[model samples]
Target: MMDARHDHPKLVLPPPTYPAVLFVMAWVLDQHLIPPFIDSVSSAPLLGAILVILGLGAAGWAVLRFMRAGTHVEPHKPTLAMVMDGPFRFSRNPIYASFFALFAGVGMIMKLEWTIVFLPILWLCLRLWVIAPEEAFLSSRFGSEYEHYRQKVRRWL
Candidate 1:
């Protein structure tokens, strides 16, 4: 049976809040939690800083790839074509996944246990709010083609 929720399109913007929230949370944790924890774990501030930069670079690359793929038919709307090449081939939502990974990498480098604690929260937010809706929209729009792609590729590998 068709789920009624599928009748409506997915909310794409709100899902992005997870990353923003994580960013703020990471900052807070770094300022507060990491210092206290630093007594037990040796600090690698330099290495951590490097990882944060690298992670941002990776996430930026994914975003650039998405923009270069195509111009949207509607200026403010989603692109019509399914981008299956580049980073998209590895993960359906490379941008979002990359952001998540970047957050994780940043948290790890900063040694913020509290930020790490929010990783699962970020994942849950993406899964329930963003991914679920995007999946529904794509499935509704592409049907079997999307199903085939979903079957072949992991959501965020």
Candidate 2:
């Protein structure tokens, strides 16, 4: 029988402890903090609901465009090229931005104020854990070309 073990170092598991902490915090706030705040402004009319739906649709479209841009290249692997055109021109991390928009829009539509709290947390996590490391890897890989694209594009719009 062939052995499965390899000589190469295994990939380090990024600590998801923080996300769990944030999830707990969100739950607590949802139970306590948001309800009272929402009581004052929970009545979103039909037009407002429609607008939220449209915004979510737009965000979904952006996500699809980002996926189809052939920029991802590798799944769960750092991007090889700095994708600066298409939706990326507006937001360097359109996939992450789409997630933010989708979550925020749903929160607004549902009057679940606590869900909006996840938006910034998600952005911060992506910035610290995902974007920064990816930036370092790409900068090292592509050098000046990547830097030029970074200079032109905002990290998030």
Backbone collisions counted per model: 0, 0
User: lDDT of candidate 2 vs native?
Assistant: 0.58
Q: Largest lDDT belongs to which candidate?
A: 1
User: How high is the CA lDDT of each candidate model?
Assistant: 0.67, 0.58
* Model 2 clash number: 0
As for candidate 2, its clashing pairs are none
lDDT of 1 by residue, 65-125 (tens): 6567763312125545565666667888766676666676666665666666787888888
Shift of residue 68 alpha carbon in model 1, Å: 3.3
lDDT of 2 by residue, 22-55 (tens): 5556657777765635545645434346655655
